[model samples]
Target: MFLNNLFSKIFRNQNRIEYTTGKAVPLEEIYLSELEKYPIWIYALEEEDVEGQDEFWVKPITNSTNVEAELSTPYILLKIKENNCPVSALLDIENMKLDDLQYWDYKYGNWEELNKLDMPSPIHLISIPSILGKPAVEFSVDIKPKNQTTAIARTLMGPDECKDMYKTLPPNICPVCHTPLKREINPNFIVSNKRSCLRYTYDSFCIVTEDFKNFCTLNHYPNLEFKEFPKSPGNYYFTPLNIFPLDPIRQKIKFEECCSSCGGFKGAYGSSPGFKSKNFTLPSNDFIYRSDIEFGSEEKKSPLIMVGLETEIKMKKFGLKGIYFDDIYE
Candidate 1:
């Protein structure tokens, strides 16, 4: 059956050769809103974009960081440092309705409605990842970084095509991103024996392990789907089916550019989907929820996936490697 499906697969129109590589550049510096005394004002480098945002709020018990290495930069560089303030912060606007968070207009010298395009980074982290007071929400899982043993299979159409190449991981809509760039995906990503699990990039990418797939199936966590790779039986192109809408403004979400043909956002989310509130209802154990916002740029466009507490505990108890959770998203 696998061979029949593979051979019958129709190759889509090939455009340019694949060149999207998901990589993280060094962050200019660490940023957090908790230490600031004044309103958050990012985008200082550009005067036209000079504006004050409602600081992203976090009722934290404490704060900390383990980002000893590099981090994903704001696609356009937002970690601006002022003389009085080391790092300017955005408004603490997460989960709150649009009418809630306002913008500070420098010209009028009065707070006004914020446009979605002008929203700043939502949550800043320098403390414990897990919210101590929350009922059962935990911080991010520890997905292993991409290393020597990892073999990244992409859907980005290359000059030389193979069975592994695809237009989307599920052989359907590329659910993770909203890029204007033409993209072809390899849904059947293969993994190596060296690592128990894999990933060097952010969790936005829908890559996963065979064990994870089995665990989901056995546990009846239905929102996730998987496509196994024949070349490497242990690997799979994993994707989540459930979705939740994202607030483009307050979360630093928007399209830097857009593709004319598709009218899609030109790339994936510049920053991860971060919010400091847990005001929404969690999905049941049978499913997980993905933000309507997708992350990654040309190389990859995917959503930030969030699972409920039940799913989190099950995965932890099952001993899934390279998987972690964060308490940031709404």
Candidate 2:
């Protein structure tokens, strides 16, 4: 049995492509587009197979909660067919489910015997798309050695690993051509507004323009008053909108800005730089700039004022047309 196992190891090694040979291409040069054309295989191991293997079970401290307690030992392997061979092509299992009874039987019932076989046997194959979708290119194998267990350490692959592998690939290389892709932006897309302001505070007297009046009416402001503007024939004064108090002892101030037409939250600015602005489209077809001042106080009741300004420009849409990856020699 020992002699037979030794010969089997030698045979497997001989079949594997040697790194010294020019035919052995770097895994990074292989793109998902090209890989999708060919079938791949995922090797699932039983939980018992990974027991006593720290490398397989150890979780990184930063991602302990995110990592799955059970490692999906689905190691991906590409299936290559030999030319003019009488043997039948490997069966594609891309659509096969891991939980299927037939798959379970095939994996456990015959895997042991196949592993013990002295001669090369057929390998079950699947596709990357079936397992990972188009984002399969963003994943790679992460292997570490601990007590001789080479099982994958994490179930999910991170973008950093994928980026590191394809470092030689151009930053903007087209997935197919291996050349830089051109990026064009269309400056006409309307921004989708999705945030709401519950309350707001301003330090100075607020001007109620016609736009402001329309905004208040659309937003169901019950207390707002509209007065004809003396300076303009068609403009009106918007008043009584909720405003934050300029109290020196107030710890925080908040406000909401609704769209004049849709009553949606247009955008908002706060004293704190950490405030997140909600999605909003420009009130007018053209770009506009708005500014406001916020008032508050320090712990000792020292008066504080913060000026905030925002420029809402038309949304810009980007398109990727011409790009390519560096030439890959197999």
Candidate 3:
């Protein structure tokens, strides 16, 4: 009878939805309001807390560098600093309704009435070490609804692709030096251990064939000399030539090289238009980091801000990476 009771208790616990308060809510027929009662718990990295410790909270996964949480229905993954570090509890959106959630709407393309809301004022500016070891500025924005307490944290500047200061330029002109760029010709070469009979240099890597040589001679520049392959094999192997522009400005060339077969370089690299200028204007200070709260009261809060110190560390990725606040859509 004791053994039977132990098995039954285990089964019951497995089926229960545990909250941070040591309370269990049935997994089925659970309402949004029930989950909101628990404070959004923030666990230290690798800290093992009891299930349901906070119904809507975040914690680091076991033996992993990522912090994960299910904010209502949306699953969030954050890349933060070192392991075992304390996580700050920044926001709580329990009383928020689905229609009033802007974070969810923006991500899922259900954007409606987004611009009608007032932008949240910046509460704090935290400088944290990004995955790239550069100091990344995080802005904490206060949420509204006078009665509900919620906030959001995001990077001061959004993704690099979304930045407004960077611009692209047209082709032919060297992206680095703004000078006329020319193609480089070679007799033979090996790239990635593969042999090529001929090569043409531009921003894009390309190889030319014998047919391409004939086509270029007849139709294109007929005066240009084309090298002929010897009928008898020789012990000659070609060294890769540095045809790339030496000028720092010329290195950013956006023009792609073309071959005779397809009239363009195959498997081309760095084909995207290079930046027009090398200098980048920093983000404006007037910019506000918006929050997810859409239809809440416009009540204002005192600017009680907090900022974290920057730490330098090695990372696995190249660009800046961090966790941003997101809302549950479902």
Put down candidate 3 lDDT per residue, 1-330, tens digits, no spaces: 000112221211111123222322211111222223331222221222442222222231222222122322211111112222111222222321111222212222211122223444423333222211333334343545331122111111101111111123223434333322332322332222111222222222233344434433343321333333243122121122211111124324233344334343222223112211224221322122221111111111011011011100111011112211111110
Model 2 root mean square deviation, Cα atoms? 26.0
Q: How close is candidate 3 to the true structure, as a TM-score?
A: 0.15
Of candidate 1, the 10-residue stretch with the lowest lDDT total is 153-162
| Candidate lDDT (C-alpha), each | 0.35, 0.22, 0.23
The sequence of per-residue lDDT tens digits that candidate 1 reaches over residues 1-330 is 000021111121212122122211111111233222211112112122212111111121112221111111111101211111122222112221111222222332222222221324342212122122222122111222222122111111001011224333433343434342332334344443322343322223455666777887787766666666676676666566776555466557657566555566656553443552234454443346666665656444666666655665566567554443443344
The number of clashing residue pairs in each candidate reads 38, 19, 9
Per-residue CA lDDT of model 2 for 27-72, tens digit only, reads 2222223223332321111221442221111111121111121223
The reply for model 2, stretches above 4 Å from the true place, is 1-205, 241-330
Q: Pairing residues by index, what is the TM-score of model 1?
A: 0.42
Report the Cα lDDT for candidate 2.
0.22
Model 3: per-residue Cα lDDT at residue 98: 19
What's the true lDDT of residue 92 in model 2?
Answer: 19
Q: Which ten residues in a row have the lowest lDDT in candidate 2?
A: 154-163
Top TM-score model: 1
Q: After superposition, how far is residue 126 of candidate 1 from its true place, in Å?
A: 23
Q: Give all candidate RMSDs, comma-separated.
A: 20.1, 26.0, 24.9
